[model samples]
Target: MRGQTQTASAGGRWRGDGAAAWCWWWVAVVLLLGHLPSCARAGLLESNPGLAYNFYKNSCPSVDSIVRSVTWAQVAANPALPARLLRLHFHDCFVKGCDASILLDTAQSEKTAAPNLSVGGYEVIDAIKAQLERACPGVVSCADIVALAARDAVSYQFKASLWQVETGRRDGTVSLASNTGALPSPFAGFAGLLQSFSDRGLNLTDLVALSGAHTIGVASCSSVTPRLYQGNASSVDPLLDSAYARTLMSSCPNPSPASATVALDGGTPFRFDSGYYTRVQQRQGTLASDAALAQNAAAAQMVADLTNPIKFYAAFSMSMKKMGRVDVLTGANGQIRKQCRQVNTS
Candidate 1:
């Protein structure tokens, strides 16, 4: 099995011996996570999340249920809301910590950035914030709302949620479009993805796992076209499945100005399942970033483990918990805003 190639059609899946390597480490991952509390394992305790899991228990008892209920209803209505909210969280965390900076509406806020133009669900975050204000005004932070709403969006729809967000994050007073360059690009390769994750103090495990969030989101046609036609079959990255490339080209033959979108996962685009990893393993990944997971030894090995729906679901939960902790604001650092789109009157 060492150095052997196995095509998905052959039922072996994942080229080389990655599958064999994946089998051994899969158990260790599960066992390691099972024994470690989420805070320690996700590194929330070390890099971020100075607050406790019960931070809002006494101050705002209904915060959890209210956010989940509102997010679930919105997702049920649109089905695409989860992915949008998830992207919002990623964009927020990548810039200025997870301080709700992405939610600001200033003339030069992160939302106005070129990379963040497609990110939506401002209304969802606002609605959740409004509900929280009525229930416990001036208590809950807008930053925490983004985190909770992201968790609820994916968990409620797919039942694949794994971690609870620790609260006490504050709203950042600054939001700049320039900060977005650190965020991962849809066209990034394996090295680019690694650096992007590493910039946020995340490791390869977090990169592979959190990337599964693409399982439920949509990518614009512009992002997809470059992957399909930038090069010929030989010149293009061999990781992409040929038939799948042809299929993608058919959907996005020409770049139109009207604005179009397609699911990042392509297979089970609306569900938060292990399908994304499998698609990546089979070279059917829709984005350059999605398909790049197989290019690295470490990431590909994890991809092999995550091919199983159960394993992928568990691993994804762990990674997401860690991703939410990237560069957070705790202690007396930031402020809670009355509205998510603006900082409180200081």
Candidate 2:
């Protein structure tokens, strides 16, 4: 899918499939509200008044650059950092609205949850927080660092700034492993995925777009083995492309250890692009949730539409911004943690 050219006619055909209405809705919202100079988007700013485009402009002038520098160095050192950080951010936001609750290290913290056991990049967040602490003391929140680091990590991978992340989020004091259930599972079906997103105020479009992040990451064999070998060892899920199933079976043998990993997008695992959509279209999605996209008519259309790189990038960026705003805590609500790994003692 690397050299494939996105034709205008192809885009037009997708738009004709009742997707144009919601796509136009997003365009109007993004243009009219999202791109404002002050970033005073209604839902985000109106709901969380303390959040702003430059919330730390006076308190921490170098917040964005500091995060970018650390993220750049880490991503350069480890190409896998981007995916880990991005997944970390998603897990953080989904459970508790980008409040950095997932960062807490406690007996029953979100980080200790079963689903989050594999969530890496805590050291990356700690690294960024340490730099911010030196630069601004307690001026910046761990929540904001998580958001900025995720954005910067993706930017580093894309070789450009992907989107603007509104900051000023405060770290929550709570981090319950039980709350991690809010996260969408790799095994969820289409309805379950939609329900999970909808429960977070996200729509179908956001679900489809956010899932595109799989284009760059890997999934543990435990996550995909169930999709590859269901019912009996000899049987494979019929939805999977046979060749892709064979490849997955070879890489992730039956009764494979959870430690084994496979690329989410086999074609271009390291690239941040729309190749995942093509993989999903071909029934080569690495996870059951990913393959679920093709099970629904509307979602399948979205998967088809997002095959266009331009559309995919734009939608992904906007969906990220929207996701970043989920139930955020700002103003004097949550405290700014000096370290990302623990809540404030006082």
Instruction: Indicate the TM-score of model 1.
Output: 0.86
lDDT of 2: 0.83
Per-model TM-score on C-alpha atoms: 0.86, 0.87
Q: What is the lDDT of residue 319 in candidate 1?
A: 69
Model 1 agreement with the true structure over 1-56: per-residue lDDT tens digits:
11122222233222343454355345535654674686576454566558668689
In candidate 2, stretches whose alpha carbon ends up further than 4 angstroms from where it belongs are 1-49
Ten residues in a row with the worst lDDT in model 1? 1-10
Give the per-residue lDDT of model 2 (tens digit) for 175-261. Answer: 999898899988898999999999998899999999999998788898888877788667888889999999998889988875788
Clash list (residue pairs), candidate 2: 93-98
